[model samples]
Target: MADIADPRAVEVSRSATGALASLSLAMLLSSLSTSIANVALPTLSEAFSASFPAVQWVVLAYLLAITALIVSVGRLGDLVGRRLLLVAGLALFSAASLAAAVAPTLPLLIAARAAQGLGAAVMMALTIAFVGDTVAKERTGSAMGLLGTMSAIGTALGPSLGGVLIASFGWRSIFLVNAALGIAAMLAARRFLPPGEAGQDRGATRENARFDMLGTVLLALTLAAYALAMTLARGRFGGLNVALLGMAVLGAGLFLHAEGKIASPLVKPALFRDPVLAPSLAMNALVSTVMMATLVVGPFFLSRALGLSEALVGAVLSIGPVVSALCGVVAGRIVDRWGASAMVAAGLALMAVGCAALAVLPALCGVAGYAAAIVILTPGYQLFQAANNTAVTADVGKGQRGVVSGVLSLSRNLGLITGTAAMGAVFAFAVGTKDIAGAAPEAVAGGMRFTFAVAAGLVVAAVAIAAAGGLRKRRSA
Candidate 1:
């Protein structure tokens, strides 16, 4: 075990290995639940005799719930206690999975999914928060990297796993699988994770411990509005989208106002003022947006532009996540050895190179080029995630870890929602067609190049921000 050299850091309440396993399972379960149901959308539609849009809610409900509640749940964990809440969250996720599996109606399934997402929100937030408790500060990157790897494995394994499960035991098997995993995670967490009382902020008192529920509600509503604005429109922003965006803007104003007045705010707006955190959040959002673009663009490019079959497209597309899973642990070790700030810069620089390569190389060299670019880009992403998460969380006070982790996760989720609409729109516009599925191969190729060129620019901006933040830290020091 790494030495606990930092005065504030302590050995875990139980075995670190056991705690890590529980946390890893939590991360995997949340991520797996996100993507697993997507492959079953068609089956759900047929089973429920529902329209495609209606069945789509099975996926969207979970995402929407997780997006809306992630930050608030994190803050809640801080006020109440992360360990107990994490256990409860695991139980809720497990029960909800079973509910979803047994739901006879489409609406019931959606409700179960939303509940499952609520539990996932807790899991996603607290798992990261618990890292400081479970590992030495010196090894934060490795723990962060391990979580990232589990996340990548879950994401990469989801569709393929779901496909296999569905073929063997029908659509219900997917939810059932998560149910089993959630049970195991809960048991391990109950046995191994430290208690909620142990990790509370040093100076905190019950008098000041009241949760800012109003602020949480306001933020959740505002985020839900903004997320809906980005998601519901798909590639097109119509009247509903504009109205939701307006609501989001108005809600943000109200939330800011409410937070200023609340005795215990859900998030201290002042936290964003920290040099390391401010840029880290922005960088996370920007990098997440670029990463999401690869998912948005890859399938269309592989199938339409390169004329690959669906099976081949799936196989090729899996490469990115596979790279991410393989690289996450190694990247974390590098961060521990080298330092987060430098690794952050190196990772962003590598991502920039990868994105640029993707823009040009794929168009010129096809599958080999696409594969090569993904190999570079995915590791860079893992490196950035491990370093960025380590940097952001390490700088925060212990009491704030849950809330900060939530906010960081929130930024990434928002970026993903934004990328789904914005990047996809960019690709569509570049291709010069509203009907992307019907567009010619050449148009698709040109679109892929242009879209990733934009992504590369985003990464360059992130690199500049990271450099600036590092400079600011030195001057402040």
Candidate 2:
């Protein structure tokens, strides 16, 4: 096949830097939006005179919307123009942020949040895809690495920033601030990004474009069902949970079957058939599971078991992302030198060791030990994320980058839901109480050990997968 990259694509030296900065800002904005509302949940609940569970939907709605729509929107970007979709998404996100800021009721706020999620899904799907589209192949690692750094910084800053904003201005200010940031990013994108190329293929046109609507619906159903099932499972597993799981499985099976038969499937079946892409994706999923599990469980362990304040727990939790941001630029450069597979294996090994340390050291060493464990864990995760992202796209074709990016996003989301549901279940069961206030310290400690061990085991499995994938790629080469 002839190169599908735009003939008019700007040289890396000419415009790549500004383009990267714009994309990074978009990434930071989207990532920050994901977690910023978390800190304001209590405030929102109080302001609206709503129950906690109902207010929880404010977060859940955004997540579910993003997860469900990302794949479809990504494929759409490939059919249409990524730049056009990106700008549209940013506009929508900004408008939704405004709507959310002025929402008079909890329901309206949740609806606006969902709208923001839809826009975020578009931006998330294309941010990395655009990197591949715009930057030189040789420098893709560096671009991806910096992108990861922005994500880390955004995630790490969300809670702390939200807390400060809420303290000073109130919960509405959070969405208002997002709106301003979104507008700035949108403007930056417009100024820096190249005109969208619908597709590099000569035959690409709206008349010829055939979106796999059935596959899109099936995929969306699969993700939504699974996400809902996991969310419900976090509370309790029952008949409805069983039904949702069954539906998810059915939807997944149908999606696969449809993809295999369809001409232009949302996710290309051949991509998964490739040894590198498949294993890279699996590794990404596993690593995300470990990361999210720690994020969900760590603060609880510190607060309940060690009697740490919320501020102290936030500081402890911030350690990983802070370290990730610090290491991301360097890690990207290292990936350029050493290749992604080696770095990924090393990263997984480091994560395993860190998780192991958390599993054992917390009981003996206490809060300081927990902090030390995170110090070890964060760098490994940052390294793994950068390398794994590079690895997934290394062999992907230009035309397929959007869907591939979507798959990567999907993997991370699945991992997030899985880690939260599975690890939360184990922790709750181990502690013998869902209510942390009543849980005994010994029980909480035991739960923490078990959870970390499980996380470590997951990382070990990821290491094996990475090794096997690397060997396979070497043989193929």
Candidate 3:
């Protein structure tokens, strides 16, 4: 390592701080865009005179685009340069937001949203990797924690902010706001960030520099087919759904086989073979699935089963996010001191307890009980995410940071899709009604309890896996 007292090191450290701020702001904006558009779905449906199912594509299309392209773009970042990719992503996101704000038809708006998702995938996949490249190794946990805090703040603010903007200035204002933020972030990044990685310029000259075009197409098709199949199977299962599912499996198999043989694979198989990396990724996916399932199912339970008004439901749900934000700051410090593995185990344990409370307490205490349970659950999620992210990134080498970040992002998207589909099916089966609105209050309550219990089981399994991995590590040591 270079001399610690060097003047250039000091200047670089100061610049890294500014770069971190820009990255954090971009993360917040990207997450805010995800949740903000959700509140406008009903308004858009009315304005476009579209059916509920059709208008739902506004959200689905964005998610699909992000999930499909994140890995491929991340690999590109490693080959070209993360700084260049990030700046381009910000510009694209800004342009897409402007396009969305002025769209004359629902289809145009949907297309713009998909474009926004593509930009978001680029920004998100590279942000953490950039931190790894720019910041000192010792301070990595603190920087990652701050990024997590910004994400929580965005998620917390989105719905309330969306509602206020829609009431005052209409739905277009949301996209307009995003456009402004994106432009500001882009300018800040260009001014503050250091030049691209040193070897990036030589990447084009390497004999193995060819991009994994086939692997990218196959992965995109695989995710799209699976997502569509799940959406189609929601209310009714039929031959088309079966065929789509088969197509998804075939696509996945081909992608994996192709990746294994490629000189420069989009996703290197060796990453999964690392003992530390493998378990961390698995826990990330499982924890995310449980977190998202609660988010989707909790509103249905509160609004339908308990007959709570929208305002009351929103207020109750807000408690968890607020707690999570506060906890995220503390969790980051803890990761630096106590280490990531311990925090992850402890956080998962808290989540399991909260899920158990939700499963059993609602019947006895009603709205107050559900609120109390979430109070436990949300902070746990925040802690686990911050710690787990730090752990997974720390284990990867600098050269492969981009691809590893992509894998983590992909795992999260898969978890979200899986949780929504799996929990929804269980809820429908428990209620004995295809239409949640038409189900009896008792049936809805039963469904909620069953879903929460299943979520608890998933968490317990994750906890067991974490414990086993810890044991194996100790024995090896």
Task: List, residue by residue over 1-477, the lDDT tens digit for candidate 2.
Answer: 896866456454456778888899989988899789999999998999999999999999999998999988888888778888899999999999999999999999999999999999998999988988777777777888898899999998998899999999999999999999999989888877887677543233455457779988898889999999999736588899889999999998888998888556677777788787788778888888888878778878888899889888878888888888888888888888888878889889889999999998888999888988988888888788888888888777666778889988889988888888888887888778888567888888999998889899999999888888878878888
Residue runs of model 3 more than 4 Å from their true location after superposition: 1-13, 198-205
For model 2, the local distance difference test gives 0.86
lDDT of 3: 0.85
TM, every model: 0.96, 0.94, 0.94
Best by lDDT: 1
- List model 1 lDDT by residue over 58-177, tens digit each: 999999999999998898888778999999999999999999999999999999999999999999999999998878899999999999999999999999999999999999999999
TM-score of candidate 3 against the unseen true structure: 0.94
For every candidate in turn, the CA RMSD to the true structure comes to 3.2, 4.4, 3.1
> Whose TM-score is greatest here?
1
Kindly give the number of clashing pairs for every candidate: 0, 0, 0
> Please, what are the lDDT tens digits per residue for candidate 3 over residues 1-477?
875788987788778888998999888988899889999999999989998888888888888888889888888888878889989999999999999999999999999999999999988898888878777777777777788888878888999999999999999999999999999999989988776672232323477866789999999999888878877657676898789889999998999899899787777777777777788778888888888767777888888989999898888888777777777777787778888889889889989999999998887899889988988888777778877888888857655777778888888778877777777888788888889987888999999889888999999989988898889899989
The list of candidate 1 runs beyond 4 A from truth reads 1-14, 196-205
